[model samples]
Target chain A: MILGLTIAIVVVALAAGALNLVLGLLGKAPNDLSLGALALVELALIAQVVTAIVAPLVGNPPSGNPIEFWAYLIAAVVIPVLAVFWALGERNRWGTVVLGIAALAIAVMVWRMQIIWTVQLA
Target chain B: MRVRASGDPLPLHYSVSVPEARSSLATGLGRVLVIVYAILALAATGRSVSQILSRFDEAPVAFTLSALAAVVYIVATIALVAKGPVWNRVAWIAIGFELVGVLVIGAISLLAPQLLGLPDINPFGRYATVWSDFGAGYLCIPLVLPVLGLLWLRSRRDAARQAATVDAEVRA
Candidate 1:
């Protein structure tokens, strides 16, 4: 189900975030490992995008207007991508903050997706 | 031509002072602020425009407030990211307005939700601004950003003051 994938993504994102935080605390930004983690999260988000597209196609549409769903979905995909790219340009705690914001956005997107699903179920 | 530390004149490959070369934490953190504000700018604008265009008749008050909030965020982001003393002053003003807007709107939304409610087609039938429900949506960044912005500005000012004191001491 979409819920399962979302939970998995959240777990991956949080674990990666923890690693990034550790690197940040150690005063290491732009580390290979952190960048690797960011890459993984980005890949996972790609999976999310695919899932979002398939969700309504196969089943009842998620709640809200299609325009709204698609709009938020597009934002969901774009925000983290932009954050990661921008963060990669800098090698400091600021970069870590960028990752932090990306993770936070993922969480919000998942929450929104869940709400959309719930509205449909109702 | 530039003289090396050994006092032999060397070819001037590049001319720059140590002060100019040093990168401050503000530059780094300010960049971070820029990214965050940009995200908010996009989110607010998108939501407001969609609401206004898609369902202007549903909740005119809420949609209009959303549009206004988007404008404020956009202005604040631009002012904050612009480089120069003039932009710094503008950033302060924009952020000040943001702080006031959020607080006043948040309080009103909570105490008088009816004042902001807009009729809609679906069951929910109403729209709310970023300040509504204390920014329950978008994780309340609208509520949080102003405070962080003020703190960041104060630290920058403090650093500037310290630098000035050091300069005065050196001159004396």
Candidate 2:
């Protein structure tokens, strides 16, 4: 996993999540700003996916279990997609909250992927 | 005497709203609940499948429990999404099972770790699956989910009944 990309996804995702949570609390639903923030996190995930494909080809292989790392990466990528669909289907503040939760989940999952990439003792 | 009902109330909207039918489980807060359940379903499925395929020999019990939890989440997610009384009942059953499963598994993992038959290679022996430790691994959301699901389902049921009562009164 690229350190820069990992840090970027984590920070952006967490920030997007906090923003959504604040929006939901303030009774705001999925607007341009909220959706745009989600798209930002989704872009980082896309970058992670691309880097995962290319980095291994360049000899910078992960030290940990590839299966575990990939599992997390895949899940991290899917959550936001699902959240977008759910948010569109229900344009309520809770829908925004769901997006926030998904963003938070992505952040945590990406962090775990990094752990599996660099620090899995097994 | 002629009776004219005010008809169904418009759904409360928070922002640019999507046009949808009124008063179903998969609306508003329930939508959030379903998304959470969907996330858990995906996570549990991925974890259980990977564990079972890779190291089922090392920890059969843990892997099996993981699979069960995955199935439960998947079922509950689908049930919550599908519209109708039947799916609602199915959701109740699935969520109720989830609550019992998490509570029982959490207690067992805490009190009697050996009962799980997990080997040392398994890092989080007792806490292997999502249900373990009442979902502490996932921030206890699993524990809170079913309780909220049941309450939401109950609330929806009451609303449906009240609507029916109003309809009956209008007709009479």
Candidate 3:
């Protein structure tokens, strides 16, 4: 994983999470901006996943537990999708809160992925 | 407390008994709880399954405890999402068990890691259970979830009881 790209994703996710939390606190439902930010974060995660998968084929397999790394990768991709689905279904401020939590989790997951990648490289 | 008029025709498929007001487990804040529990359940299941399948022989006791924690999390997640009195009771039991399990496992892992076959010369040494080191791996969410779950369940039960009482008074 490229360090710069990983950091960017984490920053975006955290910002989105904070925004969602504020919206939830203000009794506002998840609006376009919140969803859009999440979409960007999701796209970044997809890019990370692609990079991780392709790097291994290029003889740069993660030095750490590959299975665990892959599990986290897959889970990171799934979290936002599930959160958006639940958020749309809920149609309330709490739905936004759930999205906030999802974004926060994604940020953490990305950080973990970066750690795993660095461990392998080192 | 107005009653239906006698002249008004009932639905053709109306049941003989009145259905109690449905109390859903996934409403408002409960929805957030459900999501949190579901995430934990997924995480625990993934971790335990991977450990057990890859190297069960290395630390059987710790892996088995991890599996047990996964099971408890899964049950609690399901119970928290399903509606009805039966499911409510199941949620209470599952959440209660989760609290007890986390406390016991946390204490054991911290004070007596050797008791659970700790210090194994494996990639993921001893403390493998979800409650190990108070869920240090997952940022202590496992340690805190059950307490929140129990409080949520209690409040919901009280609300349901209050609603039932009001309904009874209206009928009388």
Highest lDDT against the true fold, candidate: 2
* Candidate 1 ranges with C-alpha deviation above 4 Å: A117-122, B1-26, B118-126, B168-172
lDDT of each: 0.68, 0.81, 0.78
Off by over 4 Å in 3: A120-122, B1-21, B120-127
What does candidate 3's lDDT look like per residue over A1-122, in tens digits?
67888898899899988999899889988889778878988998988888888887988777666665666678778888988887876688998998888889889878877776667421
Output the better candidate (1/3) by TM-score.
Answer: 3
Steric clash pairs (candidate 2): none
Cα lDDT tens digits for candidate 1, A19-82: 7766666667666677777778778878877877787789845665555555556666687677
Per-model clash counts, in order, read 0, 0, 0
DockQ of 1: 0.37
Residue B9 error for model 3, in Å? 17
Candidate 2, residues B18-119, lDDT tens digits: the string is 212133478788888998899999888887887777677876886799899999999999998885567878999999999999999878777775677643
Better of 1 and 2 by DockQ: 2
The docking quality of candidate 2, as DockQ, is: 0.49
